[model samples]
Target: MAEDRSEQEPARRPGGRTARVRHRILEAAAELIARDGIGGLRYDQVAELAEVNKTSVYRNWPDRTALVADALATFSADVAPLRDSGDIDADLVDFLEAIAAALSSRQGRALLNVVGAAHDNPDLRAVVDDAIAQRLATLSQRIKAAIETGELPAVDSHLLVEMLSGPVHLLVSRGTRELTRADAQRITSIVLAGVRATAAQHTIALAGEHDGGKTPAARP
Candidate 1:
């Protein structure tokens, strides 16, 4: 069944009719990729799903690999970056919750499937890497913004995002644990504390520098 289109319309491509045609191809590709694993993806299936002719698929993608690459890009675009809502704690919490929700979605699972398939296919791996790179860039920017505002500590933002999400990935991928609300809270607390502690340490060090690195006299 064709999924219900969201109220928000996709932006029009500069190519007018050709743009709509390409968008339909991409939409069809996303649906097929979600339904079938990356290895099972076929341009013919995409054409059938998009309700377009095979010639259109060929003209747009030229090959199965190109089709897969474009499909993965389309899928990546759907997973928008984590936003900064000004409240660092709330933002991080929301981000974690969103991760859980996304991982449970068909599209999210399909992303992992593509990752696995990319392991053997070099070209596909590049496509997957590019998608992941885009996500990581978004995450890194949010982390940096938080740090700049003193909402988070001075740290490697990329590493910090990974640290925050490492457990969530393990939980979903390993099936060792479920991402309960409580778990999300606990993860947020731990990360917040770590960031705060590091920031505090840095502040104390800077204060000491102003005091000429001298130890204060013992209090009575």
Candidate 2:
């Protein structure tokens, strides 16, 4: 019998099987969470849906919170991402459009349901908080960069994000109609204009205070 060199080789490349299993598990978990609130998620259901062993689920995630957190984190990263293309107007428009699209997606609705139910579930609340924080961090960094580069006014980045995303959420959640590119552009334009105007007013106010509450022409 010749030596079985094939048997000596690894069954699969390192991390390949593990990655696939994790992906499937996460996807099944999201679907289940979307269908049934986090309270209804069961390891056996996840295992069966994912086609993986129950032990694998437990081996990877010791508790439901960890599993849900990872699933949401993955969903946020995949579905809603903010990009910086050096054009603040276009970037903001694209970002608003992405948010509208995501909010209208299946997973996005799932996330909204989780948020609605989070008030009663401490574990779910924490998971949602963490996921939201991760998203805001990326958006905040981009807004701050724009401000530093003189592309945007000196405004609270978080507040700006809220103003920009608020309407999208409202429109999508209403289920009345789909958000259009024109809507996104209009939202971006209005918010940016308001921010710039506010910044200019603040600058004018500061200059007046420096001039002992006198206008530029009145100073002389």
- Pick by TM-score: which candidate is best? 2
Q: What global local distance difference test value does model 1 have?
A: 0.71
Model 2 ranges with Cα > 4 A deviation: 1-13, 79-81, 216-220
Which tens-of-lDDT digit does each residue in 31-81 have in candidate 2?
888778677889999989988777778887998888888778775676456
| Predicted candidate 1 versus true structure: per-residue lDDT over 14-83, tens digit per residue | 4565666677787777666666777677877777877667677776578777777776675566555577
The candidate that achieves the highest lDDT relative to the unseen native structure: 2
What ranges in model 1 sit over 4 Å off?
A: 1-17, 79-85, 172-181, 198-220
In candidate 2, which residue pairs clash?
none
Weakest 10 consecutive residues of candidate 2 by summed lDDT:
1-10
- Each prediction's RMSD to truth: 6.4, 5.7
